[model samples]
Target: MRWITSISYKNGDGEVALAFAPEIAQFLVQLKKHFTSYQLSKAAALRSTYSWRLFENLERFRETGIWEVDMDRFHTIMETPKSYRRNFNDARRFVIDPALAELAAKTNITAQVEPIRRGRKIDRLRFTFENASQMKLAL
Candidate 1:
């Protein structure tokens, strides 16, 4: 049988000892950002899940000795995704929600959002409000 192991190296344990297959390493890189070397090393030990398969024949991994299977395949099996959720609370902290509330106090008309675009060099992210006669931007 093969089982993927993610050994923790905390409180001064070689910092980072794992050497995964190239794909597995890349997958980890994508998930982590703005982390220091110490943080990255700790994050590497986190595993979403493990994958295992029992070998029918005895010679599946090695001739006779014990085997250490890389957890790449197991990571791959659990990595299939369904949907992405935007963190609305955190997003509100940064932008937009307060601005909408401010607009509500100013206008007697109802407002619907058109799409919000990312700001460029001079152009700002804009929100549009539509009443009966015309549409105006609330930027």
Candidate 2:
């Protein structure tokens, strides 16, 4: 689904305008009713693109509280290039760790990564997180 249909901007005066398809509005309203949503402020505070992407992906699974993603699929979702695919440790160090750290510090959720290993090689990553707001309410 396309989030934006058209955009207009003024060169000298810095005026900007956006036009969305009528269908998008309906879709957004339905999405709010059917799926979990995140705070725009929190999303904006994320320092890296990876952090923002991971947060959105995790937020969708908030009801389940856990998400298991295969390394290949995760890399695809994160748009990692071929060079980074060969080194899981480097990828985790440069991408996943920083993103998860920023996410934990700046957002109302916390996540832990559990690597699933296959005979000395890591295959998948299991992510577990809890909604802090819900946890507080439970207490």
Candidate 3:
């Protein structure tokens, strides 16, 4: 099913209108009522899929400022390649670093990821994030 079914322009005024599928319209209305516009705008502005996904996951922990995920889950969520999935250096260099950089540059979030070691190998990741909006409220 498509989200946007049609688009049109108004006569003379040159205004544009979008016609969304019913499910999409309902979902958008709900999002508008319940979600913050700032967060939505930030998500829209992000260029990397990794950055966008990371932003979404971190927003849930804005109040707590921390998120921990198993390496396997992180790999699944970020869709890292087989090579990168097992290699922490490659994953961090190719996936994590770029995503974090984009998020810092494009959004008001500052985040850092630290790998947790289990025995001799990395097993999990701990993410600490601070949102500018949250910081302003705290100040």
**Which numbered prediction scores highest in TM-score against the true structure?**
2
Across 1-139, the per-residue lDDT of candidate 1 in tens digits comes to 2132454565765575455666577667776753223223222322222111111111122233223322233123323222211332333333334434433333222333233333522211222333223324458
Q: Which stretches of candidate 3 lie over 4 Å from their true place?
A: 1-38, 134-139
Q: Judged by lDDT relative to the true structure, which candidate is superior, 1 or 3?
A: 3
Better of 1 and 3 by TM-score: 3
Off by over 4 Å in 1: 1-89, 114-126, 131-139
Off by over 4 Å in 2: 1-36, 134-139
Q: lDDT per prediction? A: 0.31, 0.84, 0.85
Candidates in order: C-alpha RMSD to true structure: 22.8, 7.9, 6.5
Assess the local accuracy of residue 138 in candidate 2 as a C-alpha lDDT between 0 and 100: 20
What C-alpha lDDT, on a 0 to 100 scale, does residue 71 get in candidate 1?
27
What TM-score does structure 3 among the candidates reach? 0.68
lDDT of 1 at 66: 29
Residues 31-126 of candidate 2 have per-residue lDDT tens digits of 767866777876787888899889998988988989899989989988887776889888889888998888877787799889899888889999
Candidate 3 per-residue lDDT, tens place, 1-139, comes to 8888999998999899999999888788778656533447667778888898788889877779999999999989888899998689999998899999988877889999998999999999999989876322222
lDDT of 3: 0.85
Residue 14's lDDT within candidate 1 is: 57
